[model samples]
Target: MKRHSIQTYRRIIQITVAITFIILPLLNQLGFTFIWGNFLNIHIGDLTLSDPLAVLQVTLKNQYFSPRLLMSAGIILIIAMCFGTIFCSWICPFGLLSELVHGLAKRVLPNTFKKLNFQISGFKIKIYILSLGLIFFFLFCTRPIINQLSMPLWYSQIFQYLFIQKHISFAVLFVAVILFAEFISRNRLWCRYICPQSFLLVIAKLLNPFHLKVGYRKEKCIGNKNNNPCQKACSLSLDPRTLNNLLETECNNCGDCIVACKKLGKALNFQFSRHFS
Candidate 1:
């Protein structure tokens, strides 16, 4: 029997989550109230799961803390601490869509267009955006305004609006526009640079140095230093061989590079250690 790659399992989980959200709203409409709410705040019976950034924004805006909300968000943060933002690669519907769009763009666009150099670090830009948005919201907004920028929330809410309200949300067009822009640029601009929601996950992952991450063993590597298949396999254009500090923060443990390296030299792998080698 042929063993499936990590990406195959990741895609299964991603597709399952995407389909589950679409069906959840329909089930709620049909009078099943066991599971409710969108990705920003979801409840399954007595348990709740929420976006940590949304929870933080609400706590800041209201000057109050809800233990329930904190606990819900903590669950997600703990997962990030252990697995390094696997939420983006394994479960987010918008992520799955973005990856698909990026794949299509790479196939259709010219090679020259795909090689544009981005001098600014994407993670730093995300932190800057997160900081500026929080500062602006803290001074000027009354509500959890940052929640408005969550693509995963919007993705889930689209199904909620359609199934429960029988209304089409403009968010469909919003997400489509972002995907279209990414396709044209041959880049995952939103996931890579713009999404503020992921910053919390990145921070959580950073807090724990022993969290699961890609480890590259240079001795095991047999590929060229500059032009390796593992590097080419990265959708985010990251070189697995050099995932240190800021560069590591951008990796979601998607395992594409590991899979790409498996046949060649098996140099890359998932490990729970501080050292990359």
Candidate 2:
């Protein structure tokens, strides 16, 4: 398949999943009670799928575990282990919003200013935040304070409240502020720097060395040595050329870089193997 075709398919899936969250909540308001709850906790008939991290927090605090919660969390963790947090690329509503705003910023901003690099890496910051949150949870019996920073959960909750409860949440304001910052800064500040939710998934993916990932063919790259198109196309500012390590922890396998490389060198492709180099 053409590289753009692969990316277009991913975009369609991303848009569909984002819309599903919005429509499902409205369905409940219209008396169709087939599904309910936000991303933190979702129920469909007898089956449930929930945030594994949220489940972990509750289990730790109460010193109790429900079969249903464990099952739901297991399903999500299994998916992450196999596909390396594909949820961030293909299912997150907030990721869609961030990508849209970032794309527009890319077009308007000069090339030299488009990619911003903070001295502190976003991935390390998220790990630090996750460590502290878990420490607080154990010491203070905190009520999953990390959940409060979840933009996608907030995105889904906004719709659930608006449709199911006839109420508006202040969480919408948080999303708006984050999006505005992303637009001006031309960086996915929230997803890269502060989202503690994806931290667990990243660890799971790292443990699974054979997870699907974007691969790079260094021999075929014909682009200018100084300027890499694949790197430029990355929404999260990841260097796709570094296939040896593949930056598995932070990359969501979004395929934007693959599409960008296809036109110039056809060096990047998605593969389902542990051999990255």
User: Top lDDT: which candidate number?
Assistant: 1
Each model's Cα RMSD = 1.4, 2.2
Per-residue lDDT value at 70 in model 2: 88
The models' CA-based lDDT, in order, is 0.89, 0.84
* Collision pairs in model 1: none
- TM for candidate 2 is 0.92
Candidate 2, which segments miss by more than 4 Å at Cα?
1-4, 110-115, 244-246
- lDDT per residue as tens, model 1, 62-169: 889989889999999999999999999998999999999988987888877755447467899988888889999999988778778899999999998998889999
What lDDT does model 2 reach?
0.84
Tens-place lDDT per residue, model 2, 50-136, is: 888898898888889888788899898889889888889888889899999999998897877746667456778887898898888
| Sequence-dependent TM-score of model 1 | 0.96
Position 96, candidate 1: lDDT: 96
Residue pairs in steric clash, candidate 2? none
Model 2: per-residue Cα lDDT at residue 224 = 70
TM-score of each: 0.96, 0.92
